[model samples]
Target: MTTIDPGAELKARIAEIKERFAIESAGGKLTVRRDDGLYRHLEVEMPKSSAYWFEVMTWPGALAITGHTGSHIFRRDEDMLLFFRTCMGPGPDWKIDTRYWAEKVQPDGIGSTGVQSYAEDRVKAYIKQAAQEAEADHPGLLAEVEEELFSRYSKADLETEAGAKAALAAFEFDGFRFDTAGWEFTEYDYWFLYTCQALAWTVAQYDARVQVAA
Candidate 1:
């Protein structure tokens, strides 16, 4: 399908959110609310009949959401969107940084490590090429080699350089080569398969948390 660009996509989503919601900010607090939207069409906190809205909060190491609607946790077709960034830890602009998660893959910052997140198309093409070259060098080489390794030695034996070299000798037969290192993994990128899961969990936390608070 389509490739992912997490940072760009996040920004776009934030912009669209701005268009649909009214945002209020002061010091360590922020609020996002909507005017014309009703609460029935949305998945909200099920308030006991009152106004409804939605919110998203962010800081150095925290993110949260809160809202209400027409009545009884008024659900709405479109949600109120409020985004907050405090002047607490880091500077005001884009406070979330390397510490927000891991380096390299997550934030697209490559320093000493040679880490990179690959697009699906490139990954697929690379796999196809590597497979073609590998099969050409020796048919069923990878599978046969694995079976031979297990049949020849125990896990301890394979731990040694000599044992590993011997077991994987097929890889060096005539001229077989492949990039053994795959692309890097990160939570920040939309390409990350877990993006949806993570977002759902964030909202779930808000749901559980507000329920307890109320």
Candidate 2:
């Protein structure tokens, strides 16, 4: 029997997500880029269904209306778990609360693949609990959460093939940073723009030997 590599499979999964958003007919498709820190990011540019482009994108932070400018950021860092932990309080209005997941599943026997355990009943239980709690806090939050979580993420609709390639080429090489406590959407956008500007700072980190090898 042939052995399958889990790491390779994870990468493939990321690629699959990118492929899903590669359509061109509305604005553009999604793009994914790999970084040195084992971070791979997927960015999708949404289209306007309104006469006024700016008005089309206006939405309260984390609310589910049709077509909003947002990106689902995921990282392998254990620290990202804090966001999930915080969700158990007021709850993450927009996304799944993974901290409750750890609480329900108990991290001990989580399995080497990490993917397998995701299908377990405990994961579903955490999702249900989080959903119930969120719904209790604000009933609409559940519908919004479900829409973002389970809705068909059929790729952005671009006008032409060239436009699709342009969108892919536009993926900024920077990752994002945000403090849920302090930053609003505008602040988040500001930092995201600046982070794109600072992406090249990574190039300077290489030692002369490493630079030469590259």
What is each predicted model's overall lDDT from 0 to 1? 0.33, 0.29
lDDT of 2 by residue, 143-185 (tens): 6534433346624222333433343333221231111232111
**Best-fitting candidate, measured by lDDT?**
1
Candidate 2 regions with alpha-carbon error over 4 angstroms: 24-214
TM-score per candidate, in order? 0.25, 0.19
True lDDT of residue 50, candidate 1: 38
Model 2, position 165: C-alpha lDDT score: 33
Clashing pairs in 2: 24-158, 25-157, 25-158, 26-157, 26-158, 27-157
Global local distance difference test of model 1: 0.33
Which structure among the candidates has the greatest TM-score? Answer: 1
